[model samples]
Target chain A: MEEIIKRAYLESLDGRRFGDKKEEVEKIREKILSAKKIVVATNNQKKFNIIKDIISKICNATITMIDIDTRFADLTRVPALNKGLMALDTETADLVIARGRLGVPGSGSMLVILDGKGRILTASLSPSSIVHRENIEDRIKKEIIEALSRIGINLEKY
Target chain B: MEEIIKRAYLESLDGRRFGDKKEEVEKIREKILSAKKIVVATNNQKKFNIIKDIISKICNATITMIDIDTRFADLTRVPALNKGLMALDTETADLVIARGRLGVPGSGSMLVILDGKGRILTASLSPSSIVHRENIEDRIKKEIIEALSRIGINLEKY
Candidate 1:
């Protein structure tokens, strides 16, 4: 898992410069394949449910949703608790996936995956045009699969 | 401004335990007052506009909206670029205010203000109920003033 995450980080760095969504997704998919336990961190239950549902359908990994504020209520007062530190403190998960408000109305969201050490493995801003489509669930699912395929994860087998 | 940010950071550590909205706002208000130049960082243009509008109404500080991806397109490929490092690299601003997707369907937003050093001075998860009100613009304006007042800022003068 660590090796996969390191490779993902390296690939993500290369992909981000060119804004290559395919490469970014491919790297993340590789990390996801090696991850046995994952935590989806967010304050909104709705977003959590959607993400949890989607991940479950594609992988056999153990998934959990953590309410950011609830889990870090104590740290909220800690002045040094930046996003990375907050994420790093989640010791239970090999991978931490966090969702935040994109400030855009109707679709489009930022998906960031962090390793146990709080290193950002991959981040992507989902295009609103596609996210705002009628079948958002299906679209998201398809995107996830396509991205994962680059890393050799066949959703059909899962 | 450094002193104000320090004081706000200290106060934030105290108020986070109880989730005190007023205290959180007050600390941010102080931070804002001391900030000469501020950068509002986010990928979504709509979110940037709203935040820019709100901050402009309350203070005379120089504000700029930075599209996170545009500025860090090259760094995005860098594996070491965590959220803190990303905010820190914006050398133009004494302070960087960032907005993330809250995963909520509408209204509610998470606001985080980080000092030049990337220390989160203050953070707030605005309540959705208040955010989703009919007159959102007016409500946001009012809320900004009210929160600032806790820190002794008379928005009426600004």
Candidate 2:
């Protein structure tokens, strides 16, 4: 069977297999795990602050915000905007996280993970809508952890 | 006290009062009450279809879609975009509805209501995240009614 799109995206972010170049493989993973600067770009100042808190809850890093787009216009494109910025030599950070309305029929937001070099590394298309029995933040936290794990950046190791 | 922002926006859309030109005022209200065309604009093909269903569930009107813009980028801005189109003489419909991530610290989407001329009318912030014992669709239906009622469009009159 073929690997899912999320795995493929993560692999593209950091293409290193278990059997190849033990030292270099560990080096890339170590840099990602120990990344200290996180960049968040969105026009929603309130969400930018909330996302900053969400990131702090999982890892120790400073979040740099870029609020350069029109409100409501930039809801879902923050990830791609940062990706473009990174490629354009503007946003050079350890990691970038963007969240907005998922396209599918649901009542939840979609979170996208991008590496320092502006490569997307996750498959979070349809995170379940907030269920009554659980905290949505917790569910999203787990989703983030799982996404990072797939891309060779395990949060538990820290 | 002065009207809140939502009411004010709606007022700007249709500025007619009970004291002047009673027949003309009633004529416009009747037009709105009997609106047959609903326009929904969003880049999400899946959501475009889902919104079509939602509109059908509310009223006996057909939906026209305008899907232009990058994905994830136009989530919240759909309302304003349609408003712009209306101003630019592009979209000339009876009603416009857009839903996306609310710009606040919550796990819910924001639904904005606009008239044929792209005038907004409604104050629907803080719709509770889906609850355990309640069906969210029913709740939102009620909310939609309340919003319409505030702008003097009684859904129950149908």
* First chain TM-score for all predictions: 0.53, 0.51
Off by over 4 Å in 1: A1-20, A39-55, A63-94, A97-112, A121-158, B1-20, B39-58, B62-94, B97-113, B121-158
Going through the candidates in order, their DockQ values are 0.04, 0.11
Tens digits of lDDT, candidate 1, B2-112:
454344345446653222234444444555677788886655566567767867876577877764563332323221123334655855777776643222111133345
| Cα lDDT for residue B71, candidate 1 | 32
Q: How far does residue B128 in candidate 1 sit from its true spot (Å)?
A: 26
Q: Report clash pairs, candidate 1.
A: A13-B77, A77-B13, A100-B101, A100-B102, A101-B100, A101-B101, A101-B102, A102-B101
What value does DockQ give for candidate 2? 0.11
**How far in Å is the alpha carbon of B97 misplaced in model 2?**
1.5
Residues A1-158, candidate 1: write the lDDT tens digits. Answer: 34543443465466532222344344445566677887876555665677777678765788876545533323332211233345557547877766432211211334555666564554333333322333645544554443334234566786
